[model samples]
Target: MQALLQEAASRLHAIEDRLTVRTQIAAAVAAMSIALVSTLAAGAAIISYRHTAALIESSVAGIASSTSARLDRFMATRRQEMKLFTELEPMQRLWQGDPTELRSALEALQRNFDFTWIGFADLNGNVVASTGGLLQGKSVAARPWFKQGLENVVVGDVHEALLLASLLTQRANNEPYRFVDIALPVRDTSGKVIGVLGGHLDWTWASNLIADVQANDGNTDTRLSILSKGGMVLVGPKRETIRYGGDELADMLKVRDGTFRETVDGQQMLTAFHVGNGYRDYQGLNWIVTAS
Candidate 1:
């Protein structure tokens, strides 16, 4: 019995030592595991951040490219219509000093095209005829389109159409009407400039184009902008951070087309841009389209 009791006591001591050794081993293993987990978590976070950035850059680039292509197509169609109008027999007759015929031609153009105003101007910048009779005889000599028409087919900058707004018999809104003038020089058979033919495109059409692009995007946080060559904001969200002709546009002027990171309104943004390369057979106004 004494021998058995001594043997039992020895076994207990051995078991206790094993348990103590296991506790030490467990504590060491737990400490190592915590350190390993912490290191792995940090590495994962870095990878995730980089992946998200790459994704955003690629996505924005795709959107910008696609939107630019659509805009080019839209502008191409308008340019074709403009060219066709200039080649019409009635337009030639108007150039030959037929005011009544010119008015009829202008009326037909207004019915067929989406222009806010279609008009013909003499070399002296006097309105020979216009779709809206109110603008007849108005002097457009100081207008940008008139000056540009003397050189080449050009699209003018966006501006509030004060005169047109005043003449509107029915207005949908009190906000001033905005328009972009597209003009082409009318030349005779000898290639000498005879007159200027132009039309005003509603700025709302451009705004709607941008809005449609944004609506089709899955990202709710994304924003889009259309900027002039001089870095003026032509189209942007109705936010203070993005305003017409705002300074935020300065960052876009340096690059012709590419993806970049910029801080706008104190928030970091990834932006992609494409420069306008006029539609087929027409010189495109160098506009920048961006998606962020």
Candidate 2:
């Protein structure tokens, strides 16, 4: 009876040991399964994040491309209009030393094109005829546009309309008016450079152009600007910081045409640029058109 009892006790002990080993094995398998699942989840999350980032970048690039192209077309149209103005019969008559024809021609042009002012200057830089007759006898020899227009067609940088302000006795508001001058050399029938035909375009017209782009795209967040090659802001949003050419815009002067990522005014931006390529026979001003 004692031997039988010992055998029963030994069998019970062996069964318990086997049960403990099986439990340990099951626990190890479960731990490994959990670890594997966690690693897979992490990898999937990383992949999803990268995919989302790529999609966002692609969308931004598309918008930049479309906006840049639209702006380029707009600039091209303006250049064409200026070219056509240089070829007008009245303008040609002015080049033939008929200063009397200038007022009527300029008035017609202003009525048709909505220019702020259309002025013609003789070779001596004396204003012979003007739309408003304000600066008819004024000499523009000291102006940058006059010097530039002597050799080729030129588009002057934006500046305060000091002449216009001084000429007008009445005031619509205290706000200062700004204007951009576009000038082309007038040639006689013998191809002699005789005079210059120029016009002052209101700054508001440029602002409206940008506004139209934004309205068409329904994207108010995007920024559009026309910049000088020297990094000066020719036309931009109402924001004083951007309009004045902040430090962030410094690098843009070095880039002729391309896309880059930048931080502007504490906001991350993707910017694309298009350098002016002269349209047809017109030589472009080499300005930079930026979309961000």
Q: Highest lDDT among the candidates is held by which one?
A: 1
Error of 2 at 29 (Å): 4.4
Model 1 earns a TM-score of 0.76
Model 2 spans > 4 angstroms off: 1-30, 61-69, 89-91, 97-101, 168-173, 215-220, 223-227, 233-251, 257-292
Evaluated with TM-score, which candidate comes out highest? Answer: 1
Candidate 1 worst ten-residue window by lDDT = 239-248
* Cα-based lDDT at residue 122, candidate 2: 84
In order, candidate lDDTs are 0.78, 0.71
Report the Cα RMSD per candidate.
Answer: 4.0, 4.2
lDDT of 2 by residue, 1-292 (tens): 9999999999999999999999999999999999999999999999999998676556545654555455445556655576687777656656555666768777887887746888888899999888878689999887887778888777766688876777755446775777777787878767898888787777777678767776775553667777665666767754333432555445554454667677778988777676666566545556667777
Each prediction's number of clashing residue pairs: 1, 0
Tell me how far the alpha carbon of residue 135 in candidate 1 is from the true structure, in angstroms, after superposition.
2.4
